[model samples]
Target chain A: MRKQWLKWLLPVLAFLVAFGLGRLDSRLYRQPIGQVIAVKTVKSVKTVDNFDNQDRTTTQEATVRFLNTSRRGQTTTITNQFTYSGTVDSPLRRGTQVFLTKSSGPWRLSNFKRDAIVLALAAFTLALLMLIVRKRLWFISASIAVNAILFTLATHIQTDASRPLVWVLFSGLAIVFAVVTALFVVGWRPVCAVVVGGTVGATALAVGLGYAIFALTGYRDLHLEAVKYVTQSPQLLFFIQIVIGSLGAVLDECSDIAISIMQLDGSGKKRFNAGMAIGRNVMGPLITVLFMIFIAETFAEAVLWLRNGNAIDQTISWVMGLGFAQSLISGFGIVIAIPLTSLLATLAGKKEVAA
Target chain B: MTTLSALALTLLVLMLAVGGKQGLSDAFALLLNAGLMILAVILIAGGFAPLAVAAVIGLIVLAVTIFLSTTDMNVAGPAFVASLLVMTGVIAVVVVGVLFSHTGGFGAEDTEDLEGFSLTVGVSFQQVLIATGLLSTLGAIAEAATAVAAGLIELGDDATAAGRQDIAQAIIGTALNTLFFGFFGGFSALFIWFAKLRYPFWEVLNDQIFAGELIQVLFSVIAVAATVPMTMWVVGRRHREEG
Candidate 1:
């Protein structure tokens, strides 16, 4: 009980701390700490690299004027220079809310201070609430702490999205250890089993995925980006990050649902059946939710591609090459979670042999 | 035809798998939510104070849905409160997201593709952006409400059957992660996609479309975060009241 209270208390403290840090960061950056009333994109100029590659190198230069409603509609205009990465030409127009920091003498752009606060607050609130309602506050808190670290690590990576192979390995190992530590702090035996099981399962899945990627695209030497700020094998770290990125929720779910089933089955039942049933119920619903989460995100992009009247081959290529990779990999984690948690619950229950 | 066929099959499979009754309920919920969201898009586009209307309708749906769904009224009641409170936070974040910073353009960031499509489709640029920002966050909010409501009920059910409040609390925590990961996973995939696509850092950050998407993402995150704790507080207080 006290442990649960501490879970809530810690997040509240963290919220307060993050709140303080955000304010400090805002002050340090001298960014506008005001509300935005209206955002307008005035002009867009697309610079092309070459007429031959004109289809590819269209860069958009947008002039955005923002009214800082947070401080009684203090207004500023910032020209956001960017490229048309999406298959389209122009981007959004005037009147959207965007966080901005001082870019030059008068302009501002978005950064960590403005963005992180909302994320931090949301994470803190959810973790705190889940703890209060479920009494698994500790586990939730540990997940948040690890997620925060990963968020930081993601920000710290200097390169583009793709990491070098070596860094991915080290980071994956590091993530496993960090998450294991967190699990140990919450419910050790169960968490340990989940970590081990999930890791083994994920590894098997990754190898299969890597080979599949190899066979399908046949473009093995594509210039994968390494972590930008950190000098390491970002690819290895990328995979690890995915593992770390994915593990917390699954682990949390596995431990959480497992424990709930144990408790629900009462102190008298043989417990194995209870564990199994809990796994069954939780796994099915979670799979549905996870599927929606992944599928919806990719669906939007896929829709856009198809809407453009692209060839079926081209659409499939896009989905297979990019959008679905992480989702498919994560799907493996979701499936593995079922058996992993169930098995762990069975094993953990054994320790209390005479109960 | 292919898309329709796939969707029909998927729905049919889901209906079979989850049981006809529960599956029907969930399907109804999705349709209702999607319809309301589309209506919200129109309303917000018609310049009806998007944030305010979104809040009222979102809260109402959350309240009405939980009340209607649950067998035990008390459980539904608190979940509703949590949903509202968290929703409040989400709205505030989104509103502040657009109005707080000096970055220009409509909607949150990452709607670059949408912006172009809107232009092609002959939709007004502002309308498209507003709809995007408003609609994008709706899924997150609805998902949170569903999870909180479900969590409360599940905990309550567990508590009643087993008589261990601690276990109920544990279940709630687990469910919260379920909600968190379920939502965040979707966003992270996109975020990583942007990174891999090598959208120029400065331009991507500075782009008005990107700005709109960022605001939407940030607001949804805030909403999810707020919903969790607020749900706890409201549910706890309501539980106390009932006791």
Candidate 2:
């Protein structure tokens, strides 16, 4: 009956997600900033494919809905007719700010796409709920979401956000807090065990991954340039992202194997040896999947290089070098994370079983 | 042979060793999927209707490759049906999103950055968009098939076979998480890169190539979501039939 309820709950959940986003959007639009005062539907004619052949105009027409929000009402509707060499899609509506000026009137319509924000929110909500509803799946989403959200929030901290060093230092602390909270809530470990062990494991993993990326990237002058786009401090933030990124997968893997082993061993003292054996079994396949995923995604670039008839050396230089190096580094994190997380969970689970 | 060639050869050997005769068929499926992507670019460049043509060809090729490769016609039929259904669902969502976002038209940025290369290969923005939308969803489809196939195969692993419906239900749970993790590991890096770079959000959307990538990723997620339910339905029906 519980399962059936959850089954039928899908539509209700969908409605909630949609309504939540729509309400949020409507509220945001109602802010003092801009309210739609008028709307106009645009009708215009245009040619779509002018380069290939001149014979057809394509005769495209659509209602270009415009909105005016300012008190002055001086804004003009944004229209394709003014900017394009070809015929317009429709007559520009007076309220259509989508491509027209939102001001009182007479200015050129610069940009007009308004529906993207609503769509993004909807997509995000759907993505979140899809991964969030399942029992085990919730843990994965919680770990990633909490960490990401907290990381982003930390950016607003005056001390932490001001400098990369402070950011990493504080974030390192946040990760410890996050992991402990996650483990305690999801795994139901004692608070002390969750906090202390999470801190130790997260710190060790973060520092270790940092060393790995730096060593692999060769610490050449390129690090600075790469840091601009990738991380504030490539060396430090690389460590942080990997530490957070691997947390969910690693913790999930450990808990999964450990719980199963514990159930198999039931009512007896937890068997460390048996737990290790289970980890060993899961480790091989887990690592294989992690490795294959990273490698396979790069397959397109490989194919592109091959098709271009690029020499092997040239191909690696252009197509594979950076992506490959990053993959190896991340793969290593995935590999090491399994054991680290497994060992920690085993110890924790063992204590519970014995108690 | 070069290192990559060596690596490719090794992958082939591993696939064959592990998957045996199934590996050959898997190879055919992979080739067909990749070929569809290329053919999409070609068709769109030739000014054919990109979506309609690619959809037809993609469906035909996928169906033929999967059916020919499997002994279990029951599994192939439903899995193929599920894949197409999932693809349709994903496309509908994308079209709706495009409409609401009011994000239409190709960006000059894509042309400036990749147009030369695309032209050299006879590919266009339209073709690239179609290829990306279709191919991005392939991983989920393949995962769905493998899950169903493995489930049904396990029922007769030895002399004895389990209840078909029971096995399908169990397999559905396993496959759902596997597909998620598979996508997780592959897409995480790109996700982090985009976030870390803090590229202006509007700029990324305005650039058609990046927009294409975003669309592909979103569609792929939708594909997985749609596939899970459809796969379960198909497998359930097949199990009932066999029973």
Candidate 3:
């Protein structure tokens, strides 16, 4: 009975704490970045349908009350135009909070109460996780928060660097991420060693295979167009993306394979064959997942092309090629990790037995 | 050979080397799965509702990827049902959150990509965003559900001896690692891009593309978290019935 109460109570407590943090974070964004204001839509003068006939362009008059800076408590009237079809244009409704940006006279309305809503949704999801997983939520949450910080720091360190330096920094970061995450997830067990080994080993193999593929095709099919806002060499960045993207999935599959092997070894059965059979069982779904992610990321681009009456072959060549390469490379990492992890797990078991 | 063909050939060889017949079948399933996604995209471009198309494709992918991969109908059945339920719940939450966030459509950075495309392409970018979000999350949900289901089934009826709590704990631990690490691994490059370009914290958080990816990762993890208990319950109940 007490356990049941604790389960419910713990999630509630987590929700409150997360909510407070979210609120605090949102408040921090309100400080003098621009003219922070609360705007109420007074009226819409005209709503014109664009050439597409699916989206509307609206012209509206809004009454804005400045919330911060020297203009605090000041009220101003502004005319705003909603040109875009989607939610990129803040939906004009009575009494919506918006940020007013003033650059050389005209005040622009943007993002209607976005931060608060995002916070609410995040709080809800966190609470749901806490309720479902109970105490394990702490480890998962800590892992996410710590990794996010590390990723940010790594990104910061890699800024404005040469190609070679970028590679060195990212590789170093990947190793640190793999070690820290494995330690946090499984502790200093033999399984942890297997995970780290599998991750690094799989990553190395994937990078090698990726480079070989790139070389074999003379880099003809490489989609440099998909590379956006690249600060370093696009070729190197693309290569790094594939390596980094494979890490988590590789680590994930490695953990699964290693754990299954450990379990089989513990049973004192035909551990090697059992591990091989388990690997076969798990690989199918793991590959499916890797391909699914690849497809999902590119589906939008495919749809956009098809909508524009582009040929299916052209779409496949332009959009699907990169996604396919990414999925295939990541999938290879996962597949290779299975055997590597199994070998490591078996060796670790032997060591334990001898010890 | 082209890079794409070479990559395909290599993966096929590796798959065969690793799991042989099972690997070959899994490869076939992956092709079918990719074909379904393309078909769904074509349909959405043809004026079909994005959410409906996404949900249908998601279900079919789950069936092909999880159910078809396994020969045992008993294990496949529970995994399919549990995954479908979890996917549906997560999609609903994600769709609602997306609508509220207004994160759909192209941002200023997309101008280069959108140069050739007409803005009035008659398709709603909002629907496109939702579709992409659903697609991104389906894989993680399916992966977690199938893993737990497969793991429990392999444990056999004797798994019940360990108690439901023990099984749930073990599955949750693995599921969390798989989902969390997979997310970071996939998006590290994007984060690096943001930092290299010197995007401010607020801007990074508010950027449409970044937000879309963030929501995808969060929803995927939520779905995985939900799948753990659902799989435990379904498999546990089946064990009870058999006993």
Per-residue accuracy of model 2 over A1-355 as CA lDDT, tens digit each? 6884475456345645663454234223321222224444344333333232211222222233323234333322322442121111222333322433335664444444343444453455355345333443455445545644564444434223446565456556545644543463345544334333533463356345545434554543222222212334444443444444344334444454445444554433355445444443333233332333333333334333333444554544344443333333433433343345445555665577678
Q: Native contacts retained per candidate?
A: 0.07, 0.04, 0.53
TM-score (C-alpha, index-matched) for candidate 3: 0.88
- Candidate 3 C-alpha RMSD relative to the actual structure: 3.7
Pick the winner on lDDT between candidates 1 and 2.
1
- The models' CA-based lDDT, in order, is 0.45, 0.43, 0.70
What candidate 3 gets wrong by more than 4 Å, as runs, is A1-27, A30-55, A70-90, A94-96, A110-113, A263-269, B154-162, B237-243
Residue range B142-215, candidate 2, lDDT tens digits: 44454455455445434122354444333333333333434443343334445545545554443333443444
Tens digits of per-residue lDDT, candidate 1, B1-243, equal: 232223333443444343344444544444454345435434433436545655655665564445434445555566666666665555554444444332322323345434444222122333233333444444444445445555655667344523334434544444445444444433443444455456555445444444444554444444555555565557657667767
If you assessed candidate 1 against the hidden native complex, which CAPRI class would it receive?
incorrect
**Structural similarity to truth (TM-score) of each candidate:** 0.54, 0.56, 0.88
Better of 1 and 3 by DockQ: 3
TM for candidate 1 is 0.54
> Per-candidate DockQ versus the true complex?
0.12, 0.13, 0.52
What range of 10 consecutive residues in model 1 chain A has the weakest lDDT sum? A50-59
